[model samples]
Target: MHSIVFIGGGNMASCIIGGMIDQGFDPLTLGVSVPSEQSKERLSKAYNIAVTSNNNDAIANADIVVLAVKPQIMRNVVLALAPALPKNAVIVSVAAGITVESLQSWLGSPRAIIRAMPNTPSLVRTGATGLFANDQASQLQKATVSSIFEAVGYCCWVESEALINAVIAVSGSGPAYFFQILDIMQSVGQELGLPEREARKLASQTALGAAQMAINSDQSPSELRDQVTSPGGTTERALNTFRNEGLESIFRQAMNSALARAEEMSKDFSA
Candidate 1:
C-alpha cells in the first residue's frame, strides 16, 4: 500500500510529488492516478512511480488521498472514489473554491478531510498554503497534512473558512500581481530607451533583491521604502507619483474584490 495517492497528475500535483520525493520519500511509495494515458506515462516516467487511470485502484491501498483535480471535476472524482476508499483514509483536497463541507457531502458523509489552497509558486518550492481541516481530522492527520504542505513551501492554518478567501487574495493571487509590476517596470524601461534584455535583467533582479531584503530585514516594507527614497531621488519621485495615484488603495481594493469572487465561487460550489 502506497502512503500517498494523488488523483491528478497536473502541474500542482507534479510539484507536490516532486517535493515529496526530494524530501527523501521513496518514489515507489507514491501513486498517481491521471485520466489521460499521456499524463500517466509522463508522471510515471518523470517521478518513477506507479500510475493508473482508476481512482479507486489508486486510493484502494493508500492512507492519504490527495484530490488535486480542478474544482469543476472534484465532485465526480470524489463520488467515484468514495465507495472504494478505506474507511479511515484521510482525504486532502487542493481544489480552489471548494469547501470541506461540500467535499464531505459529495463523498457521502462528514469524513476526515483537509481543504488546502496552495499557490502556483509551489513549483519553485516557495509557495504559501492555507489549510483548514474538518473536526474529523485527528492531531496526527493534521500534522501530516501540514508537513506535506511545508515540504513544498510554507503552510499556515486558518481559523475560519472565510479567512481562506483572504488567503486566496493575498498569497494565492499575489504572484500574478507581482508579475504585473515586473511587466510594467520592463515596459517603462523600454520606453526610456533601455535595451529589452538589459531592462528585463535589471527589473527582475531588482524585484528579487527587494523581496529578499523584505524577507531578511527586521524593518517594515514601508520603512524599507522610506530608506530607499532619499529627498529629490529618482525613487522618491516614483514613490510620490504612486502615492498621488492612490496605489496602495488600488491594491487593497483589488485584493478585496478577489476575496469576494472567491467567496462567490465557494457559494456556487456549495449550492
Candidate 2:
C-alpha cells in the first residue's frame, strides 16, 4: 500500500482521497495537512484518514506528498516541508499554473515532481487529467502516479509543459463549457412547454449520452454528428444556423482565450 499525503484538504484533495479509498486503498495509509481545524476534522471524518495542521509532519511520514494547495500558497508550503520531506519521496502537484521548476526550486532540491491539471469532474470520478513529469521521476514513480489518476478517470501524458496550457483550456475548463450548453438546452426545452424538471433531465441525459457515444464509438465526432443530421432535417436546420453563426469558430476562440489566460497565470506565478 502506498502512503500518500495531501498538503491541502480542499475539494480536489477530498475527491482524490475518495477515489483512492474506492479503489481499495487503505484510508489509514493516507494523511492530510490542512490549516483549518474544522477542515481537518471534516476530512478525517469523511475519509477516516489521519489529518494535521502541521504540513511538515504530513510530508515526513508519507512516500508521496501531494501539493494540493492553491498556486499562491504552493511555494511557501513546499519551502516549509522541504526539510522534512524524505529523500526519494515523489511530489505530485495539482496546483494550476505552478511549474515543475518552480516547485523544485522552492523545495531546494531537484525533487521528483509530477504536475497534473485535473478538473472538477474529478469529484465524480469522470475527470480528465494531463500529467507532466520531471526528469527526476523514476519509472515506478510515474506508474504509481498514473495509477492514482487512472483510478479516478482518463489520464494523458504531455511531453512539454507548454502544452499543459492547452490541456487546461480543453479539459481543465471543459466541464464548465458543457454545463453551459446543458443550461441552454434545458432553457430551450422548458420554453417549448416541457416541464422544467423533465426538461432538465432530458437535456442532461442527452448531453451525457452524446458524450458517452463520442467516447465509445470508433467514428470521429464530426462523423457521428453527420450520422444524426439528415439533410434538410431539424438537426440539419440547427446545424446550418450554428455553422452560419460560426459556432465552431466561437468555440475555437474561447479555448484559445482560455489557453492564453492559463499561460498568463503561469508567467505570473513564475515571476
Candidate 3:
C-alpha cells in the first residue's frame, strides 16, 4: 500500500480521510500534518493514524501528499515542505483557483502534480470532482489520484487544463444553481396556501426524489420531462412560462459567467 499524507486536517481533508478508511485503505498508511495540537489530536483520535504539527516530518516516507491547506498559504507551505518530499512522491492539491504552473514553480524542481476541483457536496460524499495532472505525473500516480476522489463520489479526468474551467462552470458551481431552484420552490409553495414547514419538506423531498429518479432511470432528462408535460396541463403551463421567459438562455449566461470568473481567478494566480 502507498503511504498517504495530508498537509491539513480541515473539513475537506477529513472527508477524504474518512472516505479512504471506509473503503478499507490501511489506517497505518495514512498520516496528517496540521498547525494545531487540537487538530492533531482530533485526527489521530478519529483515525488512529499519525498526526503531527510538523509538515515535513509527516511526509518523510510518503508516496503521496495531499495539499489541503488554504490557497492563500499554499505557496509558502509548499516551498517549506518541498525539500523534504520523497523523490517519487505525487502531490495532489484541492485548493481552488491555484493552477498547476504555480505549484510546479513553487516546488523548484520537477514533480508529479495534480489539480483537483471538488464542490461543497463532497462533504456529504455525493460530490462530483474534476481532475487534471501535469505531464510529469505517471499513469500510476494518476490512477492513485482517481481512486482517492472516487472513494468520496463521482470523479472524472479532463483532457486539458482549460476544461477544468468548464468543470468549474458545471459541477463545481452546479450545486448552487439547484439550491437556488429549491429555495424558490419553497418560497412559492408557502405562498400557495401551504404551511411553511410542510412546504419546505415538500420542496426538499421532491428535489431528492426527482434526483434519484433521474439518476436511477435509463431515460434522458428531457425525455422524462416531456413525459410529465401533458397536453393542456398545469405542468405544461408553468413550463411554457419558463420557456417564454428564456430560462435556458438565462442559465447559459449564468454558467458562462461562472466560467469566466474561474478563468479570471486562475489568471490571478498564474504568476
**What are the Cα lDDT values of the candidates?**
0.90, 0.89, 0.91
Q: Name the regions of candidate 3 deviating beyond 4 angstroms.
A: none
Model 2 lDDT per residue over 1-271, tens place: 2278999989899998899889988887889999998998899789899898988877776788888998997777788889999898999999889988788788887889999999899899999999999898999989988888876789999998888888999999999999999899999999999999999999999988999999999999999999999988999999999999999999999999999999888888872
- In TM-score terms, which candidate is top? 2
lDDT of 1 by residue, 1-271 (tens): 7878999989999999988888888887899999898998899889999899999988888878999999998888888888998988899989888998888888897689888899999999989999988889898989988888987998999988788898999999999999999999999999999999999999999998998899899999999999988999999998899999999999999999999999999988882
Q: Write the per-residue lDDT of candidate 3 for residues 152-249, one digit (tens) a residue.
A: 88999999988889999999999999999989998999899889899889988998888888989999989989998999999999999999999999
Candidate 1, position 168, lDDT: 96
The C-alpha TM-scores of every prediction are: 0.96, 0.97, 0.95
Least accurate stretch of 10 residues (summed lDDT) in model 1?
101-110
Error of 1 at 40 (Å): 0.8
- Tell me the deviation in Å of residue 148 in model 3: 1.0
Candidate 2: residue pairs that collide: none
Off by over 4 Å in 2: none
